[model samples]
Target: MAGWEQTRRRHRLVHDVAGDFARNGPRALAAWRPAIETEFGGLDDLLRDVQRRLHTAAEARLDALIEAPPADLDTSVAAVLDEVAEIYPDLRRLLDAHASHPAVAEGTVRFHRSVRTATGVDLTRTRSDRSRYEEKGPVRDRKPVFFARLRPVCGWLH
Candidate 1:
């Protein structure tokens, strides 16, 4: 399969495994892991690649933002918000899939904080609204629904 297709399949597998694990528990998950590792490779390696891709994409986005400054702070913040909104779901999926894994769970926490600090956007939030960027105070309190939804998966992993 093509690289993108393979990545897409891997992502689907992770999502499926996570869903099954949620319903069936660790016993079912344990059986699934061998096939998961066989087809998609190790979870650790997959997560590393996912993080690397996200970081590279973030850097490129930041570079673009720097190269062409927005009209004002609102515009700049909005740009970052939009970028994070686009990226967070995939990252959240990878994190959710391997939340039980020690290294990956720690990485997820770090990634969440770093993204929030850098972009002033709460990645944990499930929904994105362009209007939210209009207000300064509300943005800070934004809940990470995406992270919340995946919390159980991590709990199960442990």
Candidate 2:
């Protein structure tokens, strides 16, 4: 099937499964869970793949900076930042999709707190700032400039 058709089918499947679960409760959900996973597992897999790729790229970038700092270090750093900027939206989408699930929501809260404690960076604050920009207009207009400014910090960290 075409991609759009597959997406539509999945959408219908989700609605049907949800309706069934609501009407029939836990027993129905238990029966349907495997099918639900079969249909939706690819998304979770894709998110994991993206995360692994991002981690590898980040490590490679950091290694490059440590081994032989480039002449135009800012540009090198910007490239890595740009890669992160590109990948982050997909991660956000996957997380947002699962945010309604109680377990996922609780885990996300714990992870956010851990990150804040470890990195001294408040993800909630950053998310809020990003939201403000999104509300104003297209992020494409601002992303490049924001990443450009961020390059200096990246360089300093290295």
> Quick one: best lDDT, which candidate?
1
Alpha carbon deviation, residue 146, candidate 1 (Å): 12
Across residues 33-99, which tens digit of lDDT does each residue of candidate 1 receive?
7867887577676566555545555445544555665656334534454444343444544444556
TM-score, candidate 2, is 0.35
- Candidate 2: the clashing residue pairs are none
Error of 1 at 52 (Å): 9.0
- The clash count of every prediction, one per candidate, is 3, 0
- After the best TM-score superposition of candidate 1, give how far the Cα of residue 64 lies from its true spot, in angstroms: 16
lDDT of 2 at 91: 37
Put down candidate 2 lDDT per residue, 39-123, tens digits, no spaces: 6674344334334433444445445554676666445544443544343443333333445555545554664565455444455
C-alpha RMSD of candidate 2: 12.1
Judging by TM-score against the true structure, name the best candidate.
1
For model 2, the stretches where C-alpha displacement exceeds 4 angstroms are: 1-36, 39-88, 124-138, 143-158
